[model samples]
Target: MLGVLSAMLCCGAVSAQQHEVEMIPFGNMDQWIDRQIKESGIIGGATKNVYAIGPTATVTETKAYKNMGGSPWATSNVMARVAGITKTNTSVFPEKRGDGFCARMDTRMESVKVFGIVDITVLAAGSMFLGEVHEPIKGTKNPQKMLNSGIPFTKKPIAIQFDYKVKMSDREKRIRATGFSRITDVEGKDFPEVNLFLQKRWEDEKGNIYAKRVGTMVVRYYTTTDWHNNATYSIMYGDITGDPAYKAHMMRLQVEERYAVNSKGESVPIKEVAWGTEDDVPTHLLLQFTSSHGGAYIGSPGNSLWIDNVKLVY
Candidate 1:
């Protein structure tokens, strides 16, 4: 009797059969049936084509493929690239002790503004990005010369400054600036602290380079042809100690990226891909000196000073 009672309470397991149930928590029934079916995630349902893509570092790896050791600058395997603008006869070296980078006066401006793009662009061409010129202000000449003039504070180390324009798309954009640390002693397998100056120039000085900001690019204007001047930002990439690695060839550039918020509270780096010494034009981002106006007030008696010797170092 007990066995029969148990049999009445329990039923036999049935074979797996297909059946449907109400997926809508609460709705107007068939009104959204099609929509519900679409979102139900039914097997073999007309789902949009989707494929899982892993992170870049992950997609780059797979069981069928061999594992690549590290990044381009990895000691086990390092890579360097400085491609883009074709080496035209017009091109000149931006920094010293190197080859194949056209540099010249922008000649597009009449006067420059403080913290303006023209000022930044010209400065890069004139000094950090090209030549480390000692041009002073218009009436106030000799920032560097005044230092050499046996003046007390003027003789002290100077802060490096830079201003530049990163071309913006008609749409929103991101940016990053990276450079190989100046190799003081490549043969010695050693590197020193990577310093950054306020501006991007200093014939010789130990000013704090990274104190104020990191990976910061001031977007002066939002419009392509702007109401505001171009954005100006730069950094000193040389050693304050005046070492030789400050002149060594950078195998690869290590650029850090900074961010800005959008119409939404969402923020992104200034660059989708950090600027590097790649030669590709569109894809390879560079701080090309499109044009400039103002320049350093050279301590010259009469000659107008030129900017030169701009470079990237670790």
Candidate 2:
């Protein structure tokens, strides 16, 4: 992936006739970091592999992962330690694509059985984003706070391009499984989605983050689709509330506040106060690809999304 980025950046700019495309570091999904984690001996002592989008390396130590090699990508694959027992969950994988690889995200149920008696099941939806997942997760409380979303980015790209394929679940309604409660049916069908937000953000004296939405681009797949190469979605700048393309359910302000690391090294919530003007330059970019559009712990089990060759068009 880094090699591909280097080649694209070497051209300085693509073609003057066409849109200039800049390959994001590790966005090609060719390289990955593999972690081999050993669960607690009480739970059969199984070794699990968790992956991340970064420099290619195999990590043997069972430790929390931070983004490495200047990569600006993170995944839902993670390790958790709760009640003094260690476990792992992997919903994202690096799948072979031609001579390289692509990210395959699956929405499914993960199970953990303890002492051959207690069995627990949780719904996990695979996701990839431009931020970090704080680990090892201690508990299920406030899952949003456990993630540091977005990254410092100043450029204003016209659109985002990527190759993708989606497989919708066979069920008509989504399901919710929190591992602590019985699974219940959600109202509507789930969809695979891609969202990108550009924001001008700031922090107050109390360490609370606020932002005005500078740009937004969101696309959801309602049905299964074959491989779409170089699919591009234009970024709509400023307040799009009156735009004909706007859909309230998909373009509304984030319902749950996303977290970011503050200057004091504390995770603080980012509040989207309002919309920005068309000319506003952004201070940060929040980009994500997910197998499920619904919130955490909600999705159909068989849904899957595959992505490769992500880029920003200038």
lDDT of each: 0.19, 0.89
Q: Which stretches of candidate 2 lie over 4 Å from their true place?
A: 1-17
lDDT string for model 2 (1-314, tens) is 98885664332223323879899999999999999999988877899989999999999999989999999998989999999999999999999999999999999999888887558898999999999999999987778888999999999998888999999999999999999989899989999999999999999988888999999888899889989888877788899899766777877776457899988889989899999999899999999999998989999999999999999998
Best by lDDT: 2
Question: Which runs in model 1 stand beyond 4 Å of their true positions?
Answer: 1-167, 171-196, 199-222, 227-314
TM-score to native of every candidate shown: 0.16, 0.94
C-alpha RMSD of each candidate structure in angstroms: 30.7, 6.5
Give the clashing pairs for model 2.
none
- Provide the lowest-lDDT 10-residue window in model 2: 8-17
Q: Candidate 1 lDDT, tens digit per residue, 127-190?
A: 2121111111122222222111100111111111222222222212111111122212111211
